[model samples]
Target: MDFKLTDEQVKLRKEFYDVCKDLEKRKPHGFAGLESIYDTDEGWEYHLYCAREYAKKGWISIGWPPEYGGKGTIGDKVFFAEARGYYDLPGIDIFGPEMLAPTLLGVGNEELNKRFLPGIASGEVQWCELWSEPNAGSDLASLTTSAVRKGNEYIINGQKIWSTGAHRAHWAFALVRTDPHAPKKQMGITFILFDMRTPGVTVKPLYYMDRAHVYNEVFLDDVHVPVENVVGQENEGWRVTQLLAGFERSSLGAIMMMLRQLEELVRYCNETKVGGKLLAHDPLIRNRLAQMACEIEALRCLGYRIADAQERNEMAGFEASGVHILASELQERLSWLGADILGPYGQVKRSRWSPFDGWYEKWYQQSFVLFIAMGTNEIQRNIISWYGLGLPRMK
Candidate 1:
């Protein structure tokens, strides 16, 4: 299917690009660095300030739908196009708006949607996903967190790990067991949102090998969430989570961010001398760069194809999984190449105010976290196997 955009769609994309043109000028921090600095409360506040500036500059989508605090606008093709372009520029994490917005628009209650959607759209409220735990990382249905009914409130008590951006988030949309005795593990859970400030909630930082606190361990003890916080029907959070995961994987790769990394890699190779000759001139290094360039083109086109399918409201399970697998592998290879090219200098943390702020150096150590987070490559393969190849489960 040729997923070409119309003239108006193209124009809208240009407008978004125009607004995002100065992204690089805004800040040096991208996904990898942003999380690294989110340890202190003040750091999170600074992050929020930057996000608010983006929103105020019309870089966000606040006037989306009245139900979810948006203007009730319908623009999927434009959204996907804008998202891919947004990342090319200096972009804050758009996961909350991109992943959760559609789900809320599709299934959230009018009141619940109105209250949370506007803030989310305006960058006033940040969100995190509390789906995975230590035991139930890949096999999410095996989650043991329970939320028993207590009058109009459901008392939640459990642990959630790898909650990206949870340390500074205002709220979280999580899955919990409402009917543990149900026949299938996937059948008895519900999707719910909770305020981070609620009592009985604790967020502990989880630092990566690179010395950045990008992830967290959240403990919810006797937390009380109102019944109104639940999204869709009871015992159906599994389905909601599946849908969201599909959204996550579908957005695996876009040309913008990868292209930025590629440009940096090329420069590093040209300046750094190996055997007194530029690394870029070396045949082996050239070949690797060529291979990565080809792979990036393939990933870019593949993302457009997936976006087209999603725009049509198609069942995107398999297509999304395929994209995830490709992007994850490509990222790993590129990260390894970057570290190799940087040599000893890649391990150092350059002073930001001094000079060449060592982005490549930091990226080398930090990029590995991407593969393990956001659904591991191993889990992506399992999804493709079960859904795409019709493989039988392990006995």
Candidate 2:
């Protein structure tokens, strides 16, 4: 594929970078890691501020269709994502724009998009995902979050764990079992959306080993959700879920963030002294950084390919898992390399002694999240082999 950018695309990307870099200067001091942006009230406020700023620029939904408040091409969406990652800005949740909006466009009625898309496009409503559970995270088909129909509404009662940003979200999209007695687990699932303020809904914060509060466990106790809120047919939610999952796995935002971290790591190596010389002069560190740069470029190109695929409107395929696996595992490896470079300073957190103000430390702590989130790396490999490569289907 030709990677050349047109003049208009170049201009758009530069404008996005300028705006995001300016926003970076305005963000709170201690905001570095992705979770740090949502872990505190100050951080959350900064996120909302950045979100509103980006919304004013109309940069949130550049890839959405023209009729749905989107005015830019898919290439523009890459610039927007790069801006977010370069600045570590918040307010862009995958559940809403990147994940749900695409699925809704594919299968939702006009009323659904008219009501929900506008809020998401404008960043008026933030969304959380409710797919993982205590026992059925990677094996989401076995999820037992049951939603029993009652007239015009469904009474949802179950628990969802590892729900990122649920504590701060105004809304959520979830997979619940609509037919408990179905012959197959995947056959009975239903995709539903509801207000986070529903009567029986409860969100409790779960901290990382480092004491961050970006993830939560959500309990739905008889939460009433109108049938109208279902994304597609009630018992046919699995198909809609598959559609959204494809979009979710196609995200390359984290890869851009890794690129940013790499820049910082290289700068650190240049300035920090070891054995009477800068770390950058060390042959071992130089080799490691070179290898990381190659991997990051590979992932970035994969991102470009996926974005190009989305541009063509032929995205209902199995390539997303392959992209997701390579990108997610690269995060872990990058963090590990950073940790090795920092030595004891890498383990330090928010301390005067920590290197790079404990950013690498926080990065190492949270990078493992990618492995588990959006399906485990093992699960993604299975999807790639069976769905994409067509090697074999699990019985």
Candidate 3:
């Protein structure tokens, strides 16, 4: 329950915030929104620029063990996330550093960690997830992607859709059916890593509604991966997948983004008048904003509790899923509120007509994606009900 930071953590957190604040000032001319991440080459390059900077300063290695070059705790990681999300900084990749490194620490061989951890920690490489497919998004265990093993390698052949950052990533960690004849759907699956530039690997764009190419459809045709790329046992990747999914869900970045958006909302309301009264003065807007504030605070508290549980090695609970569902749904709700407040102005960004530089406009369009990414909120709910509450399975 004690959420106070130690003096050292406080100093470290401020350093991270100062760096992000400075980056915000020095960002590219058109780098005001996440849209820049996918809509223009400048945006992409700007992201890489940020990535290298984070790598150089070791921000990317927060909370990792000292042996792995990490020099902070779980609290320090949360503090850094708030700064990154507040500034909406680019360059800190979620897939490679955030999701995979933790998974490796949990289940990978020393050699695997020694090989992959450095690239991610150094931010020299970027990674993507290859989990969902045309028909296996929510029902991920049913994924049909196959990685057939030979003596020394696995020949992977399948398709993965809705892969975020796949088009721009240097590598991917995929779940493939290594043994098709296993008795259960979740059994016999393998977690494998491979270079995106390998032969017969194709990445085609799957743009958002606003035509931004942040997600992609990755096709693998007889792609070959060395046995060393497998993270654990050849066919027991489900456990690692679950572990990684928990990390993805518990990531505090989304909550931090919502916190920043709330601040922007308050500022807009204070400055804008509607019907001869400031928007902040409207009862309905005030109520909605208040509700969002409550939800965000609760989410932040939950994040801290989860981090504490993780620190204690006592997080054998549904808190991760709970945080994911709350954060993603809250993001969607915030986006909708912003759109409703902005009215038509919310629909446009980078134009003089848009408020907040059309930042929420992009968020409004992509809001629903957050609920489904990492894993669907529906799935998270089911997990909470069945596992957390001990509810019986649905027929």
Best by lDDT: 2
Each prediction's whole-model lDDT (CA): 0.70, 0.84, 0.83
lDDT of 2 by residue, 1-395 (tens): 67999999899889988988888888787787668666899988887787788788777777777788888987788777877776677767777877888888989589999989988888888888999999998778999999999999999999999999999899999999999998989999998899999999999999888788989999999999999999999889888877765563335667878888899999999999977999999999999999999999988888888878767866645677777778878888988899999988888987789876787777777777777777788887887787777797677
Q: Which pairs of residues have clashing backbones in candidate 3?
A: 51-91
Quality of model 1 by C-alpha lDDT = 0.70
Off by over 4 Å in 1: 1-7, 28-37, 40-46, 57-59, 62-95, 248-254, 351-356
Off by over 4 Å in 3: 29-35, 248-251
lDDT of 3 by residue, 1-395 (tens): 68777788778888989999998886777575455765677788888888888888887888888888887777777888778888888777778877899999989488988999999988788898899999998888999999888889899999999888888889899999998999988988999999999998999998767677778899999999999999988889898887764553335766887888899899999999977899999999999999999989988888888887877777854778888877878888999999999888888876778888777778777777768777788888988998889999895
Candidate 1, 61: how far from true, in Å? 3.5
lDDT of 2: 0.84
Off by over 4 Å in 2: 248-251, 314-316
Candidate 1 root-mean-square deviation in Å: 3.4
